[model samples]
Target: MAFRNGTDSWVVVMFFMIVVILFPLGVGPEPDILNKISSGVIWVAALLSAMLSMDRLFHVDYDDGSLELLVLHPQPLEFIVLAKVLAHWLTTGLPLIIVSPLLAIFLNMDISSYFVLIITLFLGTPTLSLIGSIGAALILGARRSGALLSLIILPLFIPVLIFGVSAVEASILGVSSKPQLLILGGLFLLSSALCPIASAASLRQAIE
Candidate 1:
């Protein structure tokens, strides 16, 4: 559904591009300053872009009654939620990953850090989707849900945000980014194992 709609993904991509554009203006034209902050800026923007779309994960389904039917079906809701998160990542995160090199160039990111940026995002963004699913599911039909959703999910994203930026920073410094990358991979695995179950439970509660 996210892929078919196209608008959500486009918004995320545009937001990321806009962030990249704005930072350069605010920080001046120096390659040194741009390069210095590139990874952190991009990672933060990516995280926010994902958050901006998080509420849509289950909102439409909930509004249209598809969510009720989905809950009552025999298939495990956790698996269904996992599939949804995967689709969300494909529609949203993958585009960000694909276009990030261009953004990196705009930010004057070091050539060496490119690999780690892609690596960290590959390991990190699906976890973003997974984690966002739980937050979205938790707040289904709640008042002012966007604001509440961020409150629930943003803090949860901190560990991921930290390690993601750290991995690219390590690469820029000519140090091994492997440790941070491994932690990100581990975070993905952990989220994969846990978030879907939590989302499923939240959905069940919301529908009941």
Candidate 2:
């Protein structure tokens, strides 16, 4: 599932490139300025791309009635939701992290920030997926679910965005990026604890 969704979602790579390239092009060609701004722009683009891809997380299975069957499975819905979330991370989140370094280069970021960017994305994107699943579950089967999902999700995403971009910013300045990553890790852990149950509840409500 992860492989399938990831391959299907590869167009997001194009979006990422456009964001990384066009911003500097529109602003100026200064590599120093580009590096300074690159991490935030790339991460933001990745976040939006992931959000765009998230609607398909359940929509495909739901449309095919597989979601209904999964609901009836012996294992708990929480586990099922976790699986889906993991698949979402593997497909959408991991690839973004993998490509972040090249994007970071284009942005003119220092090499040291490379570790920070990857770690931040690793800690952060899971929280995005978990939160996105909540929105996905909430709007399942509803009209304009794509737009509604973003409306429900974008607000919840602000903290992750702030901390994630901050971590990169800190890295660029040669300051310890640990605190920001720690906060992101804490957010990921909290979301991991609560998001599956929340998603399951939302799924129940939507299906009912």
Candidate 3:
């Protein structure tokens, strides 16, 4: 409803681009190094972008009192939480994925690695949205929720980061990125199943 008014979609896209722009300036414009680090940098920037926007996922609903209604509604809160997560990914992750190819080209990332880069994001960003739901829920009305949300969720994001970067690196090396891809897929599945339930429980506690 607030797509026109809300800045998150624009912010995330601009945030990802800004981060990508800064890396070469910070690291020097050496082609070899840029090419080598591009995948990792892209993944890192994308991760932080997702994290940056996560607070908006539930904080808005909580502030507006809609979250409590969903929590107390007849339908299970878990399912509602899942729907929110899905919507979050659709809005945030999808744009990031769509713009990533341009970032890859700008970073001098090899064309061969583009396939892996896109695949990893397709599998990994949704996992970010799923996992972030828990952190967002836990701090719905807490003091300094954004800072606390970062601390709580950054550690949890490491494995996804690892597998995601690894997949790109593997593809760059001309090796099969299948193993890392599979791990990310598994992590997404695990998070998709658990995070909504966990977030729902937290929301229920918060509302009660």
Candidate 4:
């Protein structure tokens, strides 16, 4: 209980501090500049946060030999991989939604856009977690796994990053954001269905 609490607390605190620093640094300081760049700023922070947080997914278990046991379990490896991805979404992606409003404020976002920001994050970050799992699973045994993981996953992130930021920008422009959001949601559904199976296959290769 203590360990779980400590880990959860640390994760939340780290995410908070990292976003607080990153949004401003990426977007710049002028109020007008921030407003103009806020959509991009928030999306970039989400990307960085998602990337950083994913490295720890299998790392914790891999270090402790639990990853090996997970591979060896009688239950299908696909299900196990799905469970881990779900847990990752719960911990990291869920928090991204919760914290995006504050980050939006820092980016000088209009107050009305806050709900759309949260909704977009909710729709988008799961895809990040899911796609990231593939890279994380593939690079599990590499010497520079972290860097390799980022390289492999970064390209895959482009579509989500594009539509996610577009949704916010559309909202701010008082235009319909639904088309972009629907695209983002479709990407999430596709990734959620496929990424775990791919991650499980990659885990098999890594374990072998």
lDDT of each: 0.92, 0.84, 0.89, 0.80
Per-residue alpha-carbon lDDT of candidate 1 for residues 23-130, written as tens digits (9 for 90 to 100): 989989899989989999999999998999899999999999999999988999998898889889998999999999999999998778988899999999999999
After superposition on all C-alphas, the RMSD of every candidate to the true structure, in Å, is: 0.9, 1.5, 1.3, 2.5
Q: Which pairs clash in model 2?
A: 34-107, 35-107, 35-108, 35-109
lDDT for 6 (candidate 1): 83
Candidate 2 lDDT, tens digit per residue, 69-155? 788889999999999999888877877778877777777777788888888888999999998998988888899888898898999
Off-target runs (Cα >4 Å) in candidate 3 are 1-6
Candidate 2 has an lDDT of 0.84
Q: What is the lDDT of residue 192 in candidate 3?
A: 90
Candidate 3 residue-wise lDDT, 30-73, digit = tens? 98999899989999999999999898888777888887778778
Candidate 2 at 55: error in angstroms?
0.4
Largest lDDT belongs to which candidate?
1
Give the C-alpha lDDT of model 4. 0.80
Model 2 TM: 0.94
List where candidate 2 sits over 4 angstroms from the true fold.
1-6
Number of the candidate with higher TM-score, 2 or 3: 3
Which window of 10 residues has the lowest lDDT sum in candidate 3?
A: 1-10
Q: Would you estimate the TM-scores of all the predictions?
A: 0.98, 0.94, 0.96, 0.89
Q: Per-residue alpha-carbon lDDT of model 4 for 1-208, expressed as tens digits?
A: 0023346535653765586666567656888877877777677777877888777778777877888888899999888877887787777667766766767777678887777788788888888888999998888878987888789899999999999988988998899899998999999999988988999998888878
Candidate 2's clash total is 4
